[model samples]
Target chain A: MSATESPASTPLLAVNNIEVIYDHVILVLKGVSLAVPEGGIVALLGANGAGKTTTLKAVSNLLGAERGDVTKGAIHFRGERVDQLTPAELVRRGVVQVMEGRHCFAHLSIEENLLTGAYTQALSRSELRDALERVYHYFPRLKERRASQAGYTSGGEQQMCAIGRAIMARPAMILLDEPSMGLAPQIVEQIFEIVKDLNVRERISFLLAEQNTMVALRYADFGYILENGRVVMEGSAQALGSNEDVKEFYLGLASEGRKSFRDARSYRRRKRWLA
Target chain B: MELIFFFEVLVGGLLAGIMYSLVALGFVLIYKASGVFNFAQGAMVFFAALAFVSFQSWGWPFPLALLAALATMIVVALATERVVLRKLVNQPPITLFMATIGLTFVLEGLAQLIFGTDVHRLELGIPDDPLEIQGMLISTFDLIAAGVAALLVVALGVFFQYTRVGRALRAVADDHQAALSIGIPLQHIWAIVWAVAGFVALVAGLLWGARLGVQFALTLVALKALPVLILGGFTSVPGAIVGGLIIGASEKLAEVYVGPFVGGGIENWFAYVLALGFLLVRPEGLFGERHIDRV
Candidate 1:
């Protein structure tokens, strides 16, 4: 199918062969492609410096803020071209990106932070209230501490606040960047559970970028492994989980279930991805 | 007689502080929303007062002149946002500060050219005679100024707490990018904030001009308000009021008691000395948020 036209089964969001460059000369993402199906969760898995954030920013059209641009590519939301829209316009069309850091307004109370998320919707008073209630339902801790300044909240609560604020947008899809960063393992599990619940129950789609490869693979329907601004591997969660190469490099697993430290250091056989 | 003299001077100083608070409130409003420490605020006060006096002298009624002056402020706000701030959106704080400094000179020159360099006596017809309350005299003008400042503060507080735009302002203050990501137009918010600061300048100018004629020196009063911002934290509304009160009251009391010892100019630097000392102990000022370092 053409870039503009998609059949009924086409994904909710598709990033087609996008190349992003920063400050005119520094190329960040080289022809990255990903698709997020309707009401489905997808993971862009990468370690540090893997252009995961660049890819997410490319899709959300937030690269402009950093003087970055998509030199060549098309981003489609619901099969409609959205490469030209500003970040605010993209938000109004129900696509919101939660920035990597839990960038809650440290001065604003948690409730105020959530209220700002619902700002563009122009919802009636009751609708605004309902949206707040929906976010509170997902994050009961946020509701309890709604009046406290976001800066005073714990790392986990701040993460919840960031996600809750995105939820308040009542978005059809969310571009969540590193939800697991700076959170405890249990907190990460709880957050992923919430993402799963939102996808299954509310039918809200998610495009999550995570460095926690195992956790991402655990929850995401499909996964893409990004390395040096390129997608090296893409498959279903189960297939990737069982893939031998993925096991050795990403999952910290060798054929014998785990690699000893000395063996890992000595066994640098030059993986195909590096080549 | 001695007790009454002290009491009279004390009340007068408190009233004068309210005018300073009014000017500082203008600075606080813009700084809170856009993080720009607007040096042009004092000049805007001068401009607003000049515009008002000019409008009235041009055969306009008092209320009509007031509306025209306010309209001018709003226009200046929109223009500043479009011409200056738009180009300097992601600029460093120092750049924005320097821009406002440049804006200060431009406004002063414009006010002089447009409204004439001559000082004009502003008589608003409000009774200025001192009233004797139990043998203590209090000027009616001071009382009126106090009442008006209080009213505006309360009204601004209520508006900020209840209005939708007000909530957006708080959000913008929180994080500009976050605010933009959530669909709040940063430019529109900055424009609205500047316009509100302009409104504050009008009220400050009108009253100060009435007390001390509409002239170039009228802008100097805003300079006196800098210590108020220092004491109250540039981000706090009530901090301006309370800081003004402290500055106003302490200066008068010190001038009375310590003027002879210091050769009678203690009021000139009393507020600044106090602010400097207070800030030394607590850098954030009375109402400013304590810095929280994030990892």
Candidate 2:
């Protein structure tokens, strides 16, 4: 893992002090910043409505579709500013996003869904087949259910198909939002393992938003915790996982003896980071 | 002799249904891509046919006039995507539908202003004279028009199934945000779909104009597509064809067999009644995809 990490040079992607507003009125993200090193797996940890998804969408320029705009600061990919680029332009520059809730093309078959991901690439027939083979190599389950409709597939398979579709784009960096949403624990493990394999083997970088702090820190090299559209805490994964505040608040590991409901309620109100 | 006459009406009505299918095809193409029920399709048909005739009156040949009319429709399509739809992205479906309604009036008024409201005769050179086949009479023009519609449907099917743009179109139809995230330019896709829909409108316009003089009434022919769409499903290409045939054949058959008792002119309302009944039972139509949400 250390060999894969470069020494504080230009990171693969950098989100610097950015703010997001939706519908030209409601503010969603406020002065959040983070970075993903080359060939690294970085996690954005936050509860629902914490702006993790917004940050990822801001990087991919998908915020525009939802009437959200990155109004402040800038995003840089490989030392070049890219916050103004369209989503398709961003994809052409090798950044793709797998949306939350596995937005698979429901009417299409699994293989067709995967093929749609390669729309930006103009590959020959043999090259297209080779790309499909590469994706299937990473996700053998996708191969087994290639003929089935994506909507009919299990949650885990749909999630895999979503990731497999992203892989078909051959992206340098992927913005993954909540890969473990509504899936079994074992399935989450399997997916994280595949994500790790892709990171190491394909040298692809990941900026994943996750609510599962313990599971995310177990796999991610670095993590950032967001609260109410703000980056409240960020650190190395080990430091965050072992930190007393994170362990107590995010991981549900209170250092004191077992407490009543009132004590737990008061404990949340007294978040140390906010203080 | 009675049986032979019956076969003639059946075949003629079926061919006429193909014309309705042509108009419905335009609606389906735009709806599938952008989820907009384009009410302006009728006006487009009127506009294209009028443009073609007006161009021909200025001494352009048949092929040149046709090309010029097609170009006009393409321009209209591109302009609509840019001026109207681009600004309305992610809007509710009803809002888009209302916008198309506004577009209908704009197209109708603009076409009349440019081409004048006087009805013009359009002759495609396909003679409407009856031809005897297997001891039954059929109009050659209807036969030719049906053949053209069949060819267009086949070409569209191949385009949607085999091309990258077609795959991207389906993806866009399924989910716009997801399609964008995967790098499919929503604007480009919208422009392409509207252009294709425009092309379809042009073809329908030319054929219908040739059948029933290039007049403002040509726009009413799009109303005939409404029944076809209700019976065939709004999203399926094949559904349009099949629904058109059923509506066509059944209405003619009802006019011949059931009209005398009802004092005639049942043909216009027969399709609507059938469509209404179909809505009660199989609202999705034969090939329309039924959305099954897993709670």
Candidate 3:
């Protein structure tokens, strides 16, 4: 835990002073640390190659697959050290990552895809049946296309299947990697709404990684801005949305008082350092 | 009399096809789970029969020899997983395929060294007398082999279609990373699949050795399953069976009717020619999934 963190309430998931190196040489993430508070959505906002996906993968311990390792840092899940756990063990502990590009099992039927998600749960027959029903309930479109092969589903439906499959695991925290990539605006909105609903109803915490700053800030309770492998700024969503520097740089709204995106951001950076 | 001879040949070819399918089933099981082509599978069949016969010659009873063969196959599976497959996980399919080729040499040499290079016969207590039904001439040995192969295929099909481990195996087959992300222990799955493949190889070996003596040449017979695999598919068990049956029948027919027309012994070339022709039209084989690339 960080020295500055509050003692009143511990975050459900926390990462401290993490450094990640890929292929034993190239560094990708430097001193990155963040937390997902219990039952809250924490958005890591960044553009491509900003290390947002790396951070999420580090948390889920999937970095091993890409020859990336957390060289220095500690990860704690539910206040217990989990930096060493395998991805499967992490899922059994109620943490799962729905990978980027919506990695649906294309050969399996949509329903079969969802059932595969419950592999670790060891649910009874009746319970498994109920879980499938619940997934269908969350995404009625899934039920309509449940028997259809996942590969044939639309991009929107595949994304829903990905999330619905994650949901079937009954995860306490979902490290969702880029939920809004390559989707229509309306579909993105629908997915965000469902995520918010799931958060409210199921009390499942989320650490969402996304490039869409405005939309992520719209739904997230707290946000962190990543730029070039570093956390450039961090604030509550409302505060960040209202901040003049963030508006010009990320929100794409030029504040009359601020000079330009680059100048205003650096100025704020300097100010932050000075303080 | 000619028609009766034709039907007799047809049934005999089918039984031979079933045996080929039996060997291919072992290949399919390992391929489905690990995406490894498992070139060592044919070597395994040769090794299994050789070991079983060796144990029997050492004065062990039939049951003891059978158990010892099963145990040897299990050890081979486990060792292969640890020493070979596990080390090469996430490698390109070609690299894994090449590794299995290396494994084939190692197993074949080991089998020859331990069990000696001489040929040996396997007696499964099944009498080889022809069981004639009216005007039909059916070899009782062929009938027993067909019956055993059918039962084994059904047992495997039901196991994969209905059980939890079967679902996990399919999950691993569908996508390895997705299976891992969903909390499936991929290493355990691979181990289990190799074990299943070993068992299937043993059954294939026993039946084949019962008919033809257990020799280094049995490895060549094991290679014959590849054409059957091509005709059916590497991923589908039923496809293996059907491919086996078709190749079996076609080869027998080719050897009988066509062989007289064009020198004798067309059996060797016939099945492969059929597989090659199938490849030209339906490249993925009959039941294999068509390769689809998503942009």
CA error at residue B248 for candidate 1, angstroms: 0.9
- Which lDDT tens digits does candidate 2 get at residues B127-218? 88999998898989989999999999999999988889999999999889989999999999999999899999999999999989999998
- Ranked by DockQ from best down, the candidates are 2, 1, 3
**What TM-score should be assigned to candidate 1?**
0.94
Q: In order, what is each prediction's RMSD in angstroms?
A: 2.6, 2.4, 2.8
Q: All models, DockQ values?
A: 0.66, 0.82, 0.61
What ranges in model 1 sit over 4 Å off? A1-9, A256-275
Candidate 1: lDDT over CA atoms? 0.87
Distance (Å) between predicted and true CA of A185, model 3?
2.1
What are the per-residue Cα lDDT tens digits for candidate 1 across A1-275? Answer: 23233222588998888899998999888888778888778899977988999988887777877789999978999889998888878888889999898789898889988988987877888998999999999999999999998998998999999989988887898899999989899999999999899888889998899989899999988888888788877888889889987888787878887877776655543443363
Candidate 2, residue B190: Cα displacement in angstroms equals: 0.5
Question: CA lDDT, every prediction?
Answer: 0.87, 0.91, 0.87
Give the poorly placed runs of model 3, Cα more than 4 Å off: A1-3, A6-8, A256-275, B292-295
How well docked is model 2, in DockQ terms?
0.82
Which lDDT value does model 1 have at A159?
91
Instruction: Report the lDDT of model 2 for residue A275.
Output: 35
